[model samples]
Target: MAVYTHVPAEVLDALLTRYAVGTLVSAKGIAEGVENSNYLVETTKGRFILTLYEKRVAAADLPFFMALLDHLSAAGCPVPRAIPARDGTQIQTVAGRPACLIEFLSGVSPTTPTAAQAGAAGAALARMHLALADFTGARPNSLGIAGWHQLAANCGDALDRIAPGLGGRVADELAWLDAHWPAALPQSVIHADLFPDNVLMLGDAVTGVIDFYFACTEVRAWDLAVAHAAWCFDPGGTRFDPALSAAMIGGYEAALPLSDAERAALPALARGACLRFLLTRAWDWLNTPADALVTRKDPLAFLNRLDAYAGGGLL
Candidate 1:
């Protein structure tokens, strides 16, 4: 989560009193993600995270996110659990926004992940998928193909400001995705967003995963595609280290046996994943105002990534 909405001291204090987390020692705003406002809250009892929902996250969508966290954490997924208030409600209103207190999970996210680290992350993801297998909750992937089209429409020639020929390239990719995006595959509550930043690692092992806001029910292979795109790529997204990619896939396969169809679909699914990020990152790069608390990630990285996976077979 990011710091879009500023939390005044009094407001944070008022919100903190509702929980048994104890006296607030200090609260610091986090500047990592771009969706919600986050603060690393430290209290006498322990460390916890305080999040205030921002504009992009709909109020109705919070329940699914909260419940998913509850379910996954209960099922032993290494995810942070949201602590309900004294009244037993996990969600509370504060600073004119929906907010919640969550248990803090410790582990640094790897910048350039090793093959073994990628494998650990992948295995953790497989376990998470299994954990939520029986969850009846379903949320449509808003950033699916349709969302890609809308983002592209909004981008409209503005992409050239970042890089010439970028707009046309986006159009071509969107067309290809729409025509060939898979419809039927094993579907489940996939973590639609599984970037490296969402994973926590202690030394070589993944401690837990954070940020379930983008989690949704979708093709299971789609989750692998998302993880492959995130972990395998170098920082610039220009070079994809295949050994890391293979390790991740190998770890995942060890946990859950992927059918031939799913394995074969990796290339196409990876292509779509690349396109999805390219579209969203392009839109955010163009639209997010300068002086915003968060840094806009370069969309060109994902474009390069799409090109790298053009021939397919990441695993």
Candidate 2:
């Protein structure tokens, strides 16, 4: 989703030679996300995304990510399918990194998604969870509660560098989350990261969902909690709009009704979701090089959300 490694023309061509995706016309670096090296490559066959796994995206986990996409596509999710090479391999080595070619999905990510779009995003997510219920694989959520401490420790006191009391507040919040996080709530293969940019919209409908690198086995309703944090928060991350939150949850409930326990546990789960992003963003903000070809999302935005959630600004 970001461009840390540049793909030289010959490197790309040599890889494409093994596939029938045709001659590479152009490969433009996608400059949106902070995870991996992504390019919008146009070829004689069609357009596709070439992702070179970068930091944090382990080479061992590549099979899980690829297989999940294949599974979701087979189950009729509106996600791009992995394109295998002529020799029947789905992944290839490129730029000395694990690489794969995925069909380019149509539509654009909405900059300011509407309420209807939020609803559709929820519905689409519900459908995906239902379809993935049969998947037998298990991948631990590296960003789940068990992983938060290391991330905060990785940030160390640098979190306080972002703000005077940010480190102490993050520590306190993580401890509370570790103790009170929900235990049982209809678990399934949940899309742990469903931020707006990861969804492609054609009008109010979701044409595709990308970036399954963060997907893992977790509480089913936790997906909705992640969506609420992503879609309902304001740009400044200063406020959480109840109307937007309601529409999103309402949309999900339409497909799968929330249990009484799930309903009672949602606010805390949402607060946890916000903390996951807040810490990760804060870590990336401090570590990534400024001249890198990617946008480092503002960790302060989530800091504001942490304050909002702590102060009962989010319902």
Candidate 3:
């Protein structure tokens, strides 16, 4: 989603030689996200995505991601599968970073998603949870509660530089979540970061759910909570959309119903979701190079959501 390392045309052509994909005609750097270097590559055969893993994505986690894609694809979930090279390897070296050629799915990431789109996304998320029920791989979430504390410490008092009073609020929320987070919930492999940009939609149908880099084993309802926080908000995170929330939850329940305990624990789970993004965005906002190809996201967007969730009117 971002290009930190630049790959030349000749190097890309040579890399494609290891695969049956074809000659590279053009490759453009996608500079939207902060985690990896991505390009939309066109070859004689077809169009595909070229990703060079950069910050945050560990090389050790590549196989787990590839396997998850393959599993989901085989299970008829709408996910992009990693295209293997002729040598039968999906992971290869591109610009000295671990890279992969992925199946290109066609659909635009909605900017202002409609209720129908939210419903479809929610259903797709549930389908993903059901499809992965048999997946044996397990990777603990590195950005979970403990990581939040580490990020806050790493940020220290500098968080207030982004916004007045932000540091104290983050610290207090971490402490409160530590005391109140659910002890036990149904856990599974989840796409922990299911923001609208990560989901590709065509009309009311979900054609692709991309960006599994943040995917990890966690509480199942927590995934829904993340989606709720991401989808049911205005761009500035100032207004709540009740219709979107109802449709999303309705769609999810149609596929996989939540347990009574899960229902009761959603508000807290949602607060955790808000803090997770707030801390990470604050970390990225402070640490990412100013000259980097990616745009720094504002951390306060989720702060607004955190404040809203704390008001106790929402689910």
Q: What clash pairs does model 1 have?
A: none
lDDT of each: 0.86, 0.87, 0.94
Better of 1 and 3 by lDDT: 3
Clashing pairs in 3: none
lDDT of 1 at 196: 92
lDDT of 2 by residue, 176-202 (tens): 988889977788878889999989999
What is the alpha-carbon lDDT of model 3 when measured against the actual structure?
0.94
lDDT of 3 at 239: 95
Tens digit of lDDT per residue, candidate 1, span 80-199?
Answer: 988988889998887789988998998999988999999998899899988888898999899888888888889988988889998898888888877777768889988888999999
38-90, model 3: which lDDT tens digit per residue? 99999999999999998689999999999999999999999999998887999
Model 3: how far residue 72 lies from native, Å: 0.4
**Model 2 CA lDDT for position 196:** 92
- RMSD for each model, in Å, please? 1.1, 1.2, 0.7
TM-score, ranked from best to worst: 3, 1, 2
lDDT of 1 at 122: 87
The TM-score between candidate 1 and the true structure equals 0.97
Query: lDDT for model 1, on a 0 to 1 scale?
Result: 0.86
